[model samples]
Target: EPEVTQTPSHQVTQMGQEVILRCVPISNHLYFYWYRQILGQKVEFLVSFYNNEISEKSEIFDDQFSVERPDGSNFTLKIRSTKLEDSAMYFCASRTAYANTGELFFGEGSRLTVL
Candidate 1:
């Protein structure tokens, strides 16, 4: 079985600091997504990437947030300026094709804590 892997499992940073969360998604997956879950809320979609372009994004994904597949295997989410509300469990996920067939593989998560 394959799985997505994220780095810096837990990060603590002060407000206004820059933060970059990294993930290496399953090699064969075609679609990649970034999601965030506030402490007690359901997961919210941030952005979806395919073919080196953004396929979709949510309102929460403002100018301050950006996603890029820098190379063959790494996908990254960068928040230029952290805020208290930015603290949450950020998840990276990928699926081989579409939601109808392949299962979405999710990384354990990169927990961000903004002080």
Candidate 2:
């Protein structure tokens, strides 16, 4: 079974620093997304990418964030000027193109901490 995988399972960075979280979605998945869960809070959608472009994005995914598919296999999220509020578990997810209602496959998540 294919699944998403993320790197830097946990990251600690100083406020105002930059960070990049990486994810590798299942090869067959056509839709990819980045979501975050602030401790003790509900999960929030960050951005969604399809066909090499951003299909949709949430308010929280402001100018400080960016996503890329650099190649055929890797998807990445870059956060510039990290803030204290940016601390959270960031998840990378994907779903098949045909399964409009398909459940999203999520990675274990990369925990980001800002000091």
Candidate 3:
């Protein structure tokens, strides 16, 4: 079975630098999303993208963030300016169909750490 994959399972960056976390969502899936777990917090949705545009975004998705489908299988999340608070496990998830109400399959996660 196909599964979501994330790169650089761990990343370290200086504050104010930009970082782009990468993910390959399950093949044949349509809905893609980025969610973050801030250290010891619950996973929170950052943004959801479909049809090449953002379907929904949370308040946490401020000016510093952007999502892109740079290619057929790759989805990316860019943080323009990292902060200490940005330290977290950024998860990339996808569902075959959101309307199905099934579980969202997530990547192992890209752990981002800002110094």
Candidate 4:
């Protein structure tokens, strides 16, 4: 079975620092997405990428955020400046194909902590 993998399982940073969360989705997946859950809040979509370009993005993905697939096998999300509100569990997800019933595979998540 294929699954998504994330790096730096846990990270602690200062409020004004930068952070990069890495993920590797299934080899054959076509769509990749980044989502986050702020402690007691619901999971929120950040952005989606396909064919090396951004396919969709939520308002949360503003100027302070950027995503890149530096290598064919890896995807990364970078936050230029972290804020206390940025502390949360960031998840990486992927789907083999888009369909009415397609299922998304999610990574264990990289927990970010900002002080």
Candidate 5:
């Protein structure tokens, strides 16, 4: 099956640096979302985008993080500044539709390590 893929399975960056995590989501999908899981915390939704604009965003998606669909198949998340709390696994997910319920397929994850 087609799946979302993220580059650089693991990234180590110094604090205050910029990091751009890339993801190629499945084709023919309508909804895309960004979620993060801290070392010992549950997966938390950061933001959901549709129609080329943000549909919903959680408090965690602050000024530091921004997302964009650079092209047809590519979606990227840019962190302008990194912090120790930002060290976590970032997951890209896509769904065929935003109906009552649908399974969101996620990439293995892009692990971010901030020093």
Candidate 6:
């Protein structure tokens, strides 16, 4: 079985700092996505990427945020400036293909804490 892996399992930063969350998705997956869950809030979609281009994005992915697949095996999300509201658990996910019953596999999550 394969799964997504995220780095810096936990991050603590100042309110105005920058943060880069990294992930390595399943080798054969075609679609990759970044999602976040603020404490006590629902999971929210940030963006989706495929074929090296952004396929879809939510309003949450603002100018302060960016994603890149820098290489074939890794995907990364960068936040230029952190805010107290940016504190949350960021998740990386992937799916091999779209199917009526398909499911997305998620990484353990990178917990971001802004002081």
- The best candidate in terms of TM-score: 2
Error of 1 at 2 (Å): 0.8
Clashes of each: 0, 0, 0, 0, 0, 0
lDDT of 5 by residue, 2-115 (tens): 999998799999999999999998898889989999999999999998989999999999999999998899889999999999999999999887544877899999999999
Clashing pairs in 4: none
Candidate scoring better on TM-score of 1 and 3: 1
lDDT for 90 (candidate 2): 100
TM-score for each model: 0.97, 0.97, 0.95, 0.95, 0.96, 0.95
* Alpha carbon deviation, residue 107, candidate 4 (Å): 0.3
| Weakest ten-residue segment in model 5 by summed lDDT | 95-104
lDDT per residue, candidate 3, 2-23, as tens digits?
8999987999999999999999
Return the clash pairs for model 3, or none.
Answer: none
Q: What is the C-alpha lDDT of each candidate?
A: 0.96, 0.97, 0.94, 0.94, 0.93, 0.95
Clashing pairs in 1: none
Q: Model 4 — TM-score against the truth?
A: 0.95
lDDT of 2 by residue, 14-42 (tens): 99999999999999999999999999999
lDDT of 3 at 63: 95
Clashing pairs in 6: none
Q: Which ten residues in a row have the lowest lDDT in candidate 4?
A: 94-103
For residues 3-75, could you state the per-residue lDDT of candidate 6 as single tens digits?
8999989999999899999999999998999999999999999999999999999999999999999999999
| lDDT against true structure, model 1 | 0.96
Where model 6 places Cα greater than 4 Å from the true spot, the runs are 99-101
